[model samples]
Target: MSPNGIISISILALQLWHCAADLCNWTGSGFGADGDSRTVLQVRLRCTEGSVRWVYPGQALRVVLEPNLSYAQRTTVCIKPSRTFRGASVYIERAGELELLMTDGGRPEQVFCFRADGPQRPAIYLQASPQSDVSRPMVGFRYELLGNRSAAPNLGHSGLQTSCRPCNDTELLMAICNSDFVVRGYIKNVSHDPERQSSLVEVSGGRVYWQRSGVFEQEEGTVGASRSVSSWHGHIHTLLQCHVKPGGGEFLFTGSEHFGEAWLGCAPRYKDFLSVYQTARAARRNSCDFPLD
Candidate 1:
């Protein structure tokens, strides 16, 4: 399962499928191009790899994608893109790529391909049946990739520095649950705390905004839960940490002001950061509790 426990599949007919259609291996015979029996680039089916999530100090999530292929009817094949890269919601990131295996199976073993990392596109594709003398073409093909990540998926290939993130309103509250940060926990205290140090966040849905940390620190400011905004039914979460010293330490939560309400409400969903990123991209929409404005 690669080093990160990601199961690899050389072939994917069905069940637990994650490989690209292009990997199916295309040849000279084949079908319609993109246009028709005559067009040179017909889009059959497309499947994409997951996104990237959290990586520690030095790690990277690598993904390779290609199209399913075959040349049953005088067809020439090429890979359309089949992989992507994503970052946290708070920050903006351009589309990214992974190295793809050559269709012909030659020396340069792999090349790079980009996944649809923009807004609104999900990881999906079509499997085209080349137009032939017969009604529905009989021959079909598949695609594949060599997807794997480093020891720390959270870190990028460049070893981007990553800090702790207070998920959305849900996880943020959960993170706050056991801490002293919510000393007043009344969701009523929308005001920033000048004495308390750490970021706060509240997720209503997919929206995400930020609030300043009240406590003094030499690092980035803290964000309150109420800062995120649930937009267009998509989760947009941001992680804000109450800057503390390096190394493992204690997370002091001040519980809600309510007599029975718990602070930081619950525990954030624990997941690999790189996985989170890739999942978000492939789904084309996030499912986080976005903080409000």
Candidate 2:
């Protein structure tokens, strides 16, 4: 034990023979016959994105992220705790030191990110808290390893300050090309959650050009004169401070999706996007070809 009475458990070097075949997710229980409260379970994941589900968490679990990335590449690790997360305090282990990331019993609605490209790779450590009841809450989180820090969405605290900034022409061009989902839509509604410090923007998409995930779904609705029209509907999350309001005319929504949830990025007026696209196309400067509506 250290002078502070906190036990410093080192990550075990044992082989991970029980790794899941998917190599991106791991699901297991912490209850073992050994009954050693100090036992630390080791899990290794080698994917850009994945998840971990720990049922009946015990002493601790160390998740080592060894994604297939080059040594010279700078990667950022972002983890979104499950909404039902409980009974465990999460930490980031860096160079034998533990830094608390999330406390037990707290609902983590926001995603946490950190740089994990140093010589000593960072790992996630989950330590179970003492329990008095018979409740066996499951604790887990989904993780994503982002290689391009500049292109990645601003999810960290520092990035929150600039979350409301309007995207410039160059940023908008790149956002449309690299974002997970791109669509032409208008804001149907904006709901704010003060507790989570976020706002969900409900969008009625007229056209979906591309999407890396199933974030938007087609919905049939009646227009004027009982005419039925099909439109894509989805929700995009953003910082509450963005002050997003409804009825902003048609916009090109482009953003990334994390853990099955969409986050807002560069959103420009559809007409403005057309002007920019046309100008870029004339100059042969557009990053990718986008079908014009």
Candidate 3:
């Protein structure tokens, strides 16, 4: 289940200064430093529609700066989102792009909590951008990963876990993660004509669901009409539990292409198998544009 709202840490709201016309970077000299001087340490991060993007050589994230500090060796200031999406935090970059870092970490996830602290696991250190801080004899520190600062009570995570790699063919990626909170995924593709070819997202114990082709509107429970969503604002249909269940859940896609669609049926969860229904609703509608982020 998703929370109604989320909170942001003060550091998560760092002051940002403009850099190049096409870019903005964080440059703060704490404690000591001169305009002519520099530091050998820095934290790297970026905001986007999905997870924060770190402009690494390959556009990847994660790296250790060799800092000697124990706790919070350092931290990154986060800029809260201007709005919300799919019941998650919304972040804005200096470029005006939006993003959110949703992770299953401890209730009070410090960016490192995964699976909501349900279990201990490897650290998912995220980096946006790092700078050299010669003023301090330090390498750098690791900041938190994506997600709300205050994890939901049931926010389950076991730290960083892996799944079957999408080696070019990911048609099966959707079917696999449709069963539990543990079975979640990230989107690598977006934009499929906009009018059609919506993206998909599969979660543990949930099927690959999609967006309803409209903006952020509260959907009707199952057995209702086909909901409308904003195309540009992009509604994130959490088929994870919308159409299938009739047990007081919103999200049902009653259209032609889905009349008799069949799939690998599994034992259902939720009193009326809420998860299964939503997954199927998303699967059949062709409206599940969930992989954008």
Candidate 4:
């Protein structure tokens, strides 16, 4: 049982399962041929051998992730779950601290937090437990990090800092690193797709004309539960708190896609966000990577 009165399941018997496939580690920056740097790396934990099959009451699965933190100022750890992990709650044990950062009893797609002030690269302990009865065992999990924040100097693009709310570096980095297409553009237009009509997006580099729905699709038969669509679909999302005016100003946008069309949404409020995208773009150029699809 944890100090917080949560009964977590410890590793009864543990073995690194398929270290090559599961351990998807990468450096946020400072990529070298030798690969021995204090960059953040991703790791996976699986219950190859465990104490229980069905997650009973008062039992949870806990896996600790410890990365080399010698060269980094701080680290941000994010856990992405596979489809098998159902009815699970995420708990993050802060490095060098006993207090835990957990979801508000909700099933989150991903759990991420920053270890800004730790004595060392403390082991980021990630634990997940079932919230439902007779749930399936947690087979494994994956983690990723932006490893070289400290070594990389501030690129004079610390986000548009206004009195209202400051831009979060972690959020911007997550969107930038995970996105397929990052663009510098403007919001072409805003309209309601009552009949789900296609909208045209005018960007600086290029133009995107496609049919997309901005409305949140609810489950079938849950009519009227759907959310009203927004005009910011192909432009940029406001989460990054960008200084965006309708059909005005050039902004750095990060993009993802579905069904062979570009979905421009997440935007980083830094001038140098383009540089970050360029870095990722250069790496992907050789592979002929999938662009915004």
What is the C-alpha lDDT profile of model 2 across 1-293, one tens digit per residue? 24542344454432222334357899988786377665677888878888999999877788988777562364677888888999899887766677777779766656888777568666898888888875779998998876663335765623232368889888988888788888898899999999888899999958999888898999998989889989899999888888888876899998877778888888999999999989999999998898994
What TM-score do all the candidates reach, one by one?
0.17, 0.84, 0.20, 0.39
Evaluation by lDDT, superior candidate among 1 and 4: 4
> How do these models rank on TM-score, best leading?
2, 4, 3, 1
Q: Candidate 3 at 106: error in angstroms?
A: 31
Ranked by lDDT, top first:
2, 4, 1, 3
Predicted candidate 3 versus true structure: per-residue lDDT over 1-293, tens digit per residue: 12522323233443322222111223332322222122222333332111222221111122122222242212222221111111122222222222234431212312212221222221222222223432322112223323321111112222221222221112222322331211112222222222221222222212224322222223234344775432111112222222322222222221101101111122222322234335656677322333312
**Predicted candidate 4 versus true structure: per-residue lDDT over 1-293, tens digit per residue:** 46673433232232221112222231121122134322222333322211111122122333444444343533544444434544334455443343344433333333234443455443333333434544444433345433433212121112112122333444455554455455555556543322222233444433222223332112223336675432223333222233334545556655543223343445444345545545656666322232342
RMSD of 3: 18.2
- How big is the positional error of residue 87 in model 4, measured in Å on the Cα after superposition? 3.6
Model 2 scores a TM of 0.84
lDDT of 1 at 196: 28
Please write out the lDDT profile of model 1 over residues 83-124, one tens digit for every residue.
221110111112321122222212221112322333422222
TM-score of 1: 0.17
Model 4 lowest lDDT segment of ten: 151-160
